[model samples]
Target chain A: MSEKYCIGADVGGTTIKLAVISTEGEIVKKWEIPTDTSERGKHITRDINITIDNTLEELNLHKSSILGIGAGAPGFVDSSTGYINEAINIGWKHFDFGVELKQLTGLNVWVDNDANLAALGENWLGAGRGVKNLIAVTLGTGVGGGIIANGEILNGANGTAGEIGHVTVKTTGGAPCNCGRSGCLETETSATAIVRKAKEAIVKEPHSALSSIKEITAKDVFVTAKQGDIAAQQILSDVTETLGLALANLTVAVNPNKIVLGGGVSQAGDQLLQPLKDAYSKHCLPRAAEACVFELAELGNDAGVIGGASLVKQYSNEQ
Target chain B: MSEKYCIGADVGGTTIKLAVISTEGEIVKKWEIPTDTSERGKHITRDINITIDNTLEELNLHKSSILGIGAGAPGFVDSSTGYINEAINIGWKHFDFGVELKQLTGLNVWVDNDANLAALGENWLGAGRGVKNLIAVTLGTGVGGGIIANGEILNGANGTAGEIGHVTVKTTGGAPCNCGRSGCLETETSATAIVRKAKEAIVKEPHSALSSIKEITAKDVFVTAKQGDIAAQQILSDVTETLGLALANLTVAVNPNKIVLGGGVSQAGDQLLQPLKDAYSKHCLPRAAEACVFELAELGNDAGVIGGASLVKQYSNEQ
Candidate 1:
């Protein structure tokens, strides 16, 4: 018999990444397609189905061999029902994502928050592999988080569990966040926030290495800090300290075995992890800190799609 | 076969509250025994067993009529193993509670953090009854938190899943907590903290009604505040605001449907809940705040023992 397969779709603002994974959790084929936001992302499900059909045919596989599809979207997703309350980045709102995708693909489809899928993907084969309790933090334009407790995604009431970005880090005099709160963890640790802090620092230290860059990025700040620029080092310290404190507090609450750092800012690697660990140790309940380890996400951009596959494989096996 | 019953023991610093609960969730008998902390609490298990034996014989019940024992302990208890790493209040450290109790009673045993059990108890029959996702916060000598996700206790990797007391509310210049951290939620929101704040306020407002008292307690602060004492009112506002913010941050991470307020400090009822709810709504992510409600814990001191019974009933059904 041909090996059973599943499709994983990661719907993003600009593009949608899809993968065909074997039942054994290996990616057999992977590709991407442009996300058409016209008409409020209504075409997204149909487009994904078309691409899956084309990809399956290209692999010379029959539709019967496919187990199901798992989708991850950037929005408040009621994963139990595959309904997305809103995906502002994709211009979609109150859409029945899972049902529409299932109708188009003629297979069972599971949907989850993109960050949650990334955490699951990482747990399946990435940094948090085999760990029942984990916290996944993605440091991109904004900080995103997904928590896995007892080996399942913590989809709280209304499915907003693991909204770590919005956790207030600063009780007073904190920078404002897009979530209508001030001093969220995201405000101090997101890539954008890091760059903003660096830009502000450069204005004060015009002779610093960061001042030479046309537009200072979070990466540039890391590189400059590595070169021993005091200003850049201070910025790095501030971001990591804030992040570490937040993660430490979160650890006290969830007590995860591992914390996987992902996305663009985490690419700074140990530059971000070392100081962050120091601050976390200083702030965390010692026992929790000792039991939890920090690791950089191994899957990179494929985490969401891989997590999607994990979602499909998990639910498919249950049936 | 006779109706099965389970023993629930809430091991506190001074007393061990035990109950015989039917498999169907009814309390058949309830009582308490002073905790003998001699020999570093080693006598606790034996004492609990002897009382259970006495109770069963008095009720003319056979051993076959019993299911198992569920115990709740203070401090860092590894729920999965029933090992009390340290219950400082009770003089216990590195004690294998579950195994010892099981050996003595010859019945299955489960153990968890006292706060977590209170949450289970609340979810089972109190304010959070039937709520699959809930957060139970006990405001007492110290703050205690328990999170229930999808109807199960969220015992994290090391059993600190609901250590909401350690969650940092003041990131800087905050009072120190016993857990070797500064600005922990416990530092600002505990019963002790309330009394401490009230004492400090009364120092300046010596003409206030609170100044007339020989000793001030958390309850006194609430009552005085209700009677329009400026010093007490300020103290209540400060404590509730800090508590509300910590709870709001916790809610962002767990997103429980109901937040149950328990312990002695919560006895203030609306005086605590109203201002706390207002502060929570002001700080929590709007959607999460909108979805969640605050309720007073109904079982009072009985919550922990009731929660223990719930634990036995849950695991018995699973088997």
Candidate 2:
């Protein structure tokens, strides 16, 4: 009762990371729950509601003690209306999840693309904490991006404002991307892309360390590349070159002061950052290259949940 | 007095257009004066001040009669400090032009990129009026872009927020751009690029209409393409495809509600627009494509001066 708190939920396919955060962005309490994606994720809102209720009861807090709720979901979301688009496996589209969550929890609700939330989270409390204009890139199974310009999300006409993954990196004779485009940054630089590129390279370098691994992963490529495996190093070099070019292209387009690289691939750290910085400098305009700084995302697993809370906190403050 | 007015100046290499704009977004009067590139364009500010004072006195108004002065100049700018960067042609980098003008004229001053002002002008009084978010592109000798989101300029760090022209369209083996990058959108879609592409294609088609003309131009390419000239049609198709892909990439990155195309090349009209739109739809994500619209920039040649005035007007209103 002495302090205000907002609830945040980061929804993924396997689990939902939830948090109760203070107004100042410190997480007061946090937990995770298995995602009940049954019935096309219809049970998601109800589940969140029950979790919130049970958590508050466990803490001896009342519903009125909470401010609002914000969520990050892995789908195209119309944040203005909280409409989540697509659930291919479940045959669902446009859940209008914000309204459902609001109805169940009796609180103001905001929902946006998961990566966008991560971007907001990073800008507010992570690697890009002080920078008002920044770009957050998630090098996950698929490449994802969130752009923040002048302290607000550049959510464009639709909610797909920061779809940096799909920006064409290779115009011709490029690999196809899941986004119906070929040569997208996602196709060349994502964790999946790294694994795929390494697998292809192993055909030519049968004696390389990567070829000996039955299940080659992005981590395997990075680990071997760092240990002086020429084939794996070549694959990573190719990946970073593509990403650096894409980042350079993005820097020109958005001109963010900071670009925070996160998600799985970023874990390779210096192995990825050094080459990426080199490629970016080679590709970027002189003025932009001099001004923009590149770094890795810091908030780790908490980015999404904290970003969810930050969204709600910011929204509440605005209201 | 019963009415308020503001001064706007749009500076170019050849000429400087000035305007007296009423608070209601109407231009009361406008005129142009030659630019003095002497002293690396340092005398340009004194020239603007002298002109403003002369114009104010001629109109029987005092300097205080106007609210402030807003200006548009070419190259990267720190709008906050009014610092214009780079002047290869004129040696005019980092001129605190606004402060000098503000001091000389004894009024508030604002300055931004010329293309950005053009976008603001178009958004305020031209095609994108009432649309809070849009991307304005000037397809001049080089393509230039200005992005407006939620009614504010997205002037990213160092003021290079929307460099849409330089976005990479061809990942490998494309034309080189002035920005020192290869396969940039500017390389494929700018007026200079169009002519370059045509001249290169003419080697294979000696009997084409383009070959008949000693100096092949963008307009010639469009006209001949309209007349079923194979070489010209191919050139136009290539230009549109590249431009459409660039625009599509921009849409995915920023999700602007409207994309306003202006400048010399856009004068090709529907011959360019129809194909450009088709390619845009082909390249854009379906959801984003559905929400976004394309329109020609209205206000024409006057966009610069008016955009300058709009910036001051908006600034004054904010105050």
Using alpha carbons, what is the TM-score of model 2? 0.95
Candidates 1 onward: DockQ, in order? 0.73, 0.65
Task: Give each model a TM-score.
Answer: 0.97, 0.95
Worst ten-residue run, lDDT, model 1 chain B?
B167-176
Task: Kindly list the per-residue Cα lDDT of model 1 for residues A98-199, writing each as its tens digit.
Answer: 999898889999999999999999999899997899999999999899999888888899988999899887768888998888888889899999898888
lDDT of each: 0.90, 0.85
Q: Which is the leading candidate under lDDT?
A: 1
RMSD of each: 1.6, 2.1
lDDT tens digits, residue span A1-319, model 2: 4788888899888888999988887787899998877777788788899999999999877777788988988768888989878644333487888898999899999988889999988988899996878999999998989999888877778788898888776667788987676887888889888888888888888999998898888999998988899999888888888888778877877888999999998998998999999988877776777878988999988899888888888888778
Segments of candidate 1 deviating more than 4 angstroms: none
Extract clashing residue pairs from model 2: A171-B171
lDDT of 2 by residue, B136-205 (tens): 9999898899989767888888888887777766767888777777887888888899899889888888
True contacts kept of 1: 0.68
